[model samples]
Target: MALQIFETDPDARPAPKVKSEYTRPAFTFRSGMQRNRKPVKLDNWRIVAEELEPLKALAELLGGTAEEYSASAREPFHVLTETDSVEIVIDGAGAVEERMILWGPNGPIHECDGVEFLSPADAKGKPCGCPKELDQRKAWAQQGRGPKPNIPIRFRLAGLGYELGFGLLRISAWTFLPDLDPLKAALAAIDGEALCTLELEHISFINDKGEKIEYSKPKITVQGAYADAIAEER
Candidate 1:
């Protein structure tokens, strides 16, 4: 025997489209965060680095075209600062460079190009002395000995920070640190050469001063050899 599933009329009228305030509201819960700031766009932008070696490793890992080899190229927007779990499509790489990170009595102060760092005279300006850790790491790397874990890696990265943007996009290239777990995993997991997404997570390093300190150093969490997944919550 056949069963009759519907009780209502077959030709019932459809519900009218109702526009909710949330659909395109003037004010939203996030209005406080945005503060009604108008968005901006750019028609053309470019980024050029004197060197390209620094970006080679990550670029190759992300995979790129021959054009990406150019020392300079047009792009959309430069990264102003690290974001929370930002989505990016890796385009090309920039020169490899080292950075001298200074942690003063206050906290993390500034990071200067490693090449530009000449001598102790530079430290004369900063509160902290020449980092003994850097010297030790350098010596260990030369002799091929000592605990060489968690050495800092620096390079420039060029890519689409997000998929959606206006024609007038913000184009820029910025330095990248592979100090986070997701980035480290993304690099390691590449099967020879491949394109993939990198989900970055923000991390903080506590400055364990014997006396109480007010501030702390922020870092990207580093996890597996090849991190394809977003970082797990701590």
Candidate 2:
């Protein structure tokens, strides 16, 4: 017989409850004596300078650490040039031998696309000609070997458009990111006016086979002098 909705019967018995296999299990906390507890990673941190505690007397050798949350990042981020390039030649002993700024095949150094050396009438320097192109630079290459600055480390200039008047821009690589003492020396060398940043960049160059090879190195620049507080500190 079909049961009607909401019908009550005196002979009816209560239905038995069935347990579900998909029921969620209860959580249990482990005791401190448990051997399989997960390890804690970087639970806490402290900020300290070399002048404090274990770092005492090591201030010259060690640096300081600042909390990212508590400290504010510096301002006036510097911008490097994408086209003009510079190069630092490191000796086998990891010391810098030479630093030069390079102008590509298409640069201000050349009046035309053809390669040649700079004429004496072009500038007020010595009688020796400045190479206007890669081919022209072969003789000036170290020991008359090959073109100078075969590989370049490109960077941008800072300040108002002052560098536009120059054909070639170059400086010593040491002019960048020095140790504390050296940094102070560099500031003094530049009359406390240079504001710069160093960056690691991956750049592509064409090999003899015309295949592109990529390499990474540090790039230096002073493009953010206006907004950088360090410039003002100088």
Candidate 3:
């Protein structure tokens, strides 16, 4: 065999298209603060981003406050907005999925459809063995043997316009599962094009042991068709 050498000009090749660095933001209903070497929780919807303009816009629209914080060395800083509720536009019924997920420290360890395992390759299609009754499922979850709801609803901030990008609200609490069926039905009826409100409803009560209990639950309210919403704005 004979060896051959070839010369090429790097600049002769066309430049590749610049890839976008855009990522869909998240709408979180709770945040944790470090206190006494532990995390204290706060109930409020939070919008976080690497940039400030978008967070400011969201804070202004949702009647919240935007603030900057030191996240870490790699990303140095981040902007966040905390609010009680925000309006959004759901594109269609396909924007949401109701599933259950058991996550490990790194990622999902198992996923299910309430009755059967759906992931981890080998576990797919196997019986999940979750209790058919809701209460029993809750008990199972409490014992760390069952998955929790992991419904993710994708939507765009109602008045912010899509140029800023979409937002995702992932509902993981098992208590919120019951309330989702009606919302899912409504989204389906409207073909998923609807103006919706995402809010955290505070709940407080005393248990049988006389201990005060307080928490917040995420709620979704469909305002109307997306077209009508835009028309009214116009």
Candidate 4:
């Protein structure tokens, strides 16, 4: 056989890369805020994005004002809209796993599943040495010695003709842990086709010291299929 040299086509173009819908969320849904080293839980969801147009559109559809904020030089400008509840359709399975994430000034320093490390490549799979008791684990997390829960749920806004792309909601509150399994089961039962309402529930109670505490917890309620929901509304 004779050796031959092949020439590449000058105009040949590579196929474009396709990004996962979940990975390209248009906005983020936040349930809490921080001020002066204290956490502030909001009774409504705060929808934030780097772009203003989508947030303006969202405000129009959701009956809230979209306002822009000047962030630090290292941070991008933010546009946010607040609403008590929003209808969302989780088309398919998104990131719903419960993991512990500990962040430093740069980024995540450690990630684990309580029993084993899942990040920092060199330490992956090693025993994380987290406290077995929930209270102790919470204490460790509070003291910045352990990781905190990070459960992310991504979905498309149900209304607005489903044209606003996706919104990511990360649930980091330890109090919400008890509801994860049921929510996952509900999402799986419908094959991720259910119309769900993401809202904040105001929780108030008295502690052992007779001190009254009030806060809000994010809640997800499955409202069945989108079409069925619309038909019922009609």
Per-residue lDDT tens digits of candidate 2, residues 1-234? 887643566456566788852222111000111114552221111112211222221122223322222133221111112222322111111111222323445543322112332322454233334466644554455344333432122222233222221111122222232432343344344422344554344557899999987643334443332334534768
lDDT of each structure? 0.30, 0.30, 0.72, 0.77
Clash count of each predicted structure: 22, 2, 0, 0
The regions of model 4 sitting more than 4 angstroms off are: 1-21, 35-38, 73-82, 230-234
Best by lDDT: 4
Write down the TM-score for model 1: 0.23
On TM-score, the candidate that comes out on top is 4
Q: Given candidate 1, what's the lDDT at residue 203? A: 29
Per-residue lDDT value at 60 in model 4: 79
lDDT of 4 by residue, 81-150 (tens): 4578877887644446678998999999879998999988899999988889999999989999989999
**Clashing residue pairs for model 4:** none
TM-score, every prediction: 0.23, 0.25, 0.77, 0.82
lDDT of 1: 0.30
Per-residue alpha-carbon lDDT of candidate 1 for residues 70-119, written as tens digits (9 for 90 to 100): 22332211212222222222221211123454444564354434333323
Candidate 3 residues lying further than 4 Å off, grouped into runs, are 1-23, 26-43, 50-53, 63-82
lDDT by residue (tens digit), candidate 3, 149-207: 88887888877777777777777777787788888788888954899988878889999
Judge candidate 4 against the unseen true structure and give its global Cα lDDT, from 0 to 1: 0.77
What value does the lDDT take at residue 63 in candidate 4? Answer: 60
Backbone clashes in model 2, listed as residue pairs: 81-156, 86-153
Distance (Å) between predicted and true CA of 228, model 4?
A: 3.7
Where model 1 places Cα greater than 4 Å from the true spot, the runs are 1-83, 91-96, 101-130, 134-234
